[model samples]
Target: MSVIAVLALDGVPGPQLSAPGLAFATAARHHHPVAYEVRICAGPGFRSTGGPAPFGIDTPWGLEGLDDADTVLLPGHEGFRAVPPPGVVDALRGVVERGGRVGAVGTGTFTLAATGLLDGRRAATSRRHTRELARSYPRIDVDPEGSAVADGPFHSAAGVLGGVDLCLHLITQDHGEVVAIETERQLFLHLHAEAEDTGGTTSGAGPTSGAGREAAHSALADADREAAHGALAEAAYNAVTPPGSSLEPVTRWMEANLHRPLTLDDIAGRAGLGVRSLTRRFRAETGLTPLQYLLRTRLQSAQRLLERTDDPVERIAARTGLGTPANLRHHFQRSTGTSPTTYRTAFRAVVSGMTWPERPDGRP
Candidate 1:
């Protein structure tokens, strides 16, 4: 298990302090292999009985608590304009020196910037502070439009709810794309407050603050969007297979490792079969050759990322094992008879109840 220490300086923003633990727990719940010991550390004189975890720490660990942490998170606070205490800055730097990551959210970027760790690095902070942060730290590159920025081991979030995006990015780095999607789905299901006054006009990340990029919305109801999500996910990675199928294990493994350059022999080695037999059996069961299925899987992954995320095509291509943007575009246009951008736009409309036009050959 890894340790994630959240150091709360004086005047800690309540939401920023709590969001990381929430995102971590939700990720763990969705994917059992992910486990983290979250420590909510605070400055001296901090004490709590019922804190984030069930067994609250009687004396919240101070900067010393970060010594064993794999990731030390800092939340924005009231005194963000003032430089962090010397001890706090030293503790944060120590975590980086030992090769751990450090993340800050909202105005917390200001606090981290003061440590000089952000010098010559790009950072994201609250929109209002973008100019000030740039002016204050002349060496740092402040991204005014980005929701999150990761430079080396340092990550920073721009808006208050950008914490969700930052945490999701970390989860993706630690686990994989599929796990991050599942965790985002879990968070979406648990988000309750829609709108009390406007009959549901919530407006965080397309009306779901916890949605991040995976659960980004269409013009559908929550249930409908979830159904669409399930359908897409099932098609992309989890087509139904009969019990005791010979290729079940290999197919599951293929879905998990779509980002890898998998050939028939490599997959056959995993399934303990010869190349010919693996190809013959997989094609018989799935109606596509082993290589064909692999390409299809990669394209599906690309499509999911394109539709549900704000990530650039180049990043999506890399994540989906399409290798490069040019390669992804080549395969995507050939397979769908439309460019990736066109597919994303048309499919989102389809999910919103718009019927897709028939193909040139009159096929659906």
Candidate 2:
């Protein structure tokens, strides 16, 4: 079972902390035996606004509690500055270096960014703070339209209420779509409005933050412009699939070995199938050739890093096994049809509701 620790700080809105805990608890209770152990780790002095009614709970652990966790969650708080407490920042950095999943809820993203773990990563916090976040962390790509954004092991949300969406996403990632969807149904979120909407403005289309959420939504529309408007309905449907970890052994192996430069022969030998048979089965199951799937998978990881972290292009290339920054630029352009810098800028502007100059049209 995973040990999930939520880092609680003073000033966090009551719902921001409770939402994820409640959602994760619901997910844990589905089985006869729970799949995770969850706790709240209090940082600094334990005090919360709104008194005992909303912020009444006491924490069982302290900052040191994160050391024993497989995942660490930071809930949203108000009054964040360009800099956060050194202890809080340092603790979060350690958690990520250890390869533990570290997530932030709503304005909690400010704390995560202060840790420097998300320096260049794409992330979102409460829409109310999007401008300040972008101004403070110019390198980080802030996605407004994204209710919740996941990059590598770091997850972030745009509002306190969005914590529910973030939990659902993680549940879907850890388990399967069927399990997550069932959980959502029980929670009365019968559909993921963003995933199901055509015009992108369905009933639940805008976030609870209203104008702030709308700004982010506008950015999302621009980011997805190439999809031919409402044509995205079909594509979004196709994009929804079971979690990657639950697939067959060979597929799981591919996911595990992504950091290595692998060939068809390497995968086939491990899967105990001939090259031809493996190719046939893979195509039948995933509808893509082995090489195509590998490329897509690698690109997906690269995109997440581009969105979530400040790692240099060279480092991202090496980690994703594309060989060099040049290789990354080449393939990234071909796949996404935009340079990483432009992608980041567009995303930030949308989330911040700012306008940027047009790209050079090669005029004399």
lDDT of 1 by residue, 1-364 (tens): 8898988776665666678888888776444346778888875433332223322244358788999999988877767898686688888889999999998888889989999999989998888889998999899999987576889999987744537777877777787655565455445434532221211111212212343323322212232333343433223321222345688788778777765555566778999998789867865555444665566566756766655566667677666666556667766664445566665554544332312233352212
Candidate 2: where are CA atoms >4 Å away?
A: 31-34, 50-54, 160-162, 189-364
Location of the lowest summed lDDT over 10 successive residues in candidate 2: 194-203
Give lDDT for model 2.
0.60
My TM-score estimates for the predictions, one after another, are 0.55, 0.51
TM-score of 2: 0.51
Error of 2 at 235 (Å): 35
lDDT of 2 by residue, 3-79 (tens): 88887777767766666666776665432123677787777754773334655567668889999788888877655
Candidate 1 off by > 4 Å: 44-59, 159-162, 193-249, 252-364
For each candidate, the alpha-carbon lDDT, in order, equals 0.65, 0.60
